[model samples]
Target: MSIKGQTEQQQAEAQLAVGYYTELFKPPLEPKKLPPPAKLPPVPQPVLAQRVPGAKEESVSGAWQIVADKLKEQILLRHYSPQTLKSYSIWMWKLSRFLENKSPETVTTSDVQRFLADLAVRQQVSASAQNQAFHALLFLFRYVFKRDLGDLRDTPRARFQLASFPFRD
Candidate 1:
């Protein structure tokens, strides 16, 4: 091709390359709109009833239900895992039954001690289960009830058993 024709073709190619790079780096004309946060369904309140065998049917108070709801709220607000929430809820239900659904405000440290002892002695719960219960109660009192759980030094502890292997020398 002639020199002028070649020069025009080079200019066109350079413009095309510049256009491609500019489009590649250009910001989007409109920012993406994210969907609104989903609303969580309301949690159902657990019924407190005498679950022990041969225990007389009694109408316990619903005070513990309020505490459980508060515990759930605190756990959700802190962004804790769903499993942690479920564990805490189970422990709280057990505790409420042990306390005969007593109002959380009236619960004393001794009551907590007796409950822990009962788990160890009567229910024979595993060490990890007992520990989870302890932590759940601690969180309940600390956050939900806004009270300090006093010394439980004398509470009976659940024993941890080692897994034995028959082939071990």
Candidate 2:
């Protein structure tokens, strides 16, 4: 190849390398702050919401912070398992969203009952799951909310309880 051709090839390769590096280390695009009917995008960092451990206090929406604060106590006091923590957290999250961030004190038994009903009918979850979720939510209602639900047991999943079966010949 001629000198000019070789120089051009080297220049192209250098440009390609620079382009690849630029693409690799590119900064994340700023979220679009579009107008109405569009979301403003999440705040990115964990805002205060509440006085969390080792976290600065910043304004945040939702009841999660309060629920989370209570969660730590439950774990420390009752020694809930990690799975239970996650499950209970999920229940609280649903409840918060359902109530549209209403104060826990404002959550009525009817709200909880409706939520469970919706879970069974709309989500079609299994009996064990439904029961577990109910218990978790109940815990939040009774202990966290300091409220009563009064005999709002989940409708048992219908199943025949056969005492015994004949042995095969």
The global C-alpha lDDT for each of the candidates, from Candidate 1 onward, is 0.80, 0.64
Instruction: Supply candidate 2's per-residue lDDT for 45.
Output: 26
- Kindly give the number of clashing pairs for every candidate: 0, 1
Q: Clashing pairs in model 2?
A: 48-58
Model 2 weakest lDDT span, ten residues long: 39-48
Kindly provide the TM-score of model 2 when superposed on the true structure, using C-alpha atoms: 0.53
Q: How much is the lDDT of residue 130 in candidate 2?
A: 73
Candidate number of the best TM-score = 1
- Tell me the TM-score of model 1: 0.67
Over 4 Å off in model 1, which ranges?
1-60, 163-167
Model 1: number of clashes? 0
lDDT of 1 by residue, 1-169 (tens): 6556677779889789999999999999999899998654444455544354432323343466677789889999999877788888888877877877676788888988999999999999899989999999999989998999999999999998676434657
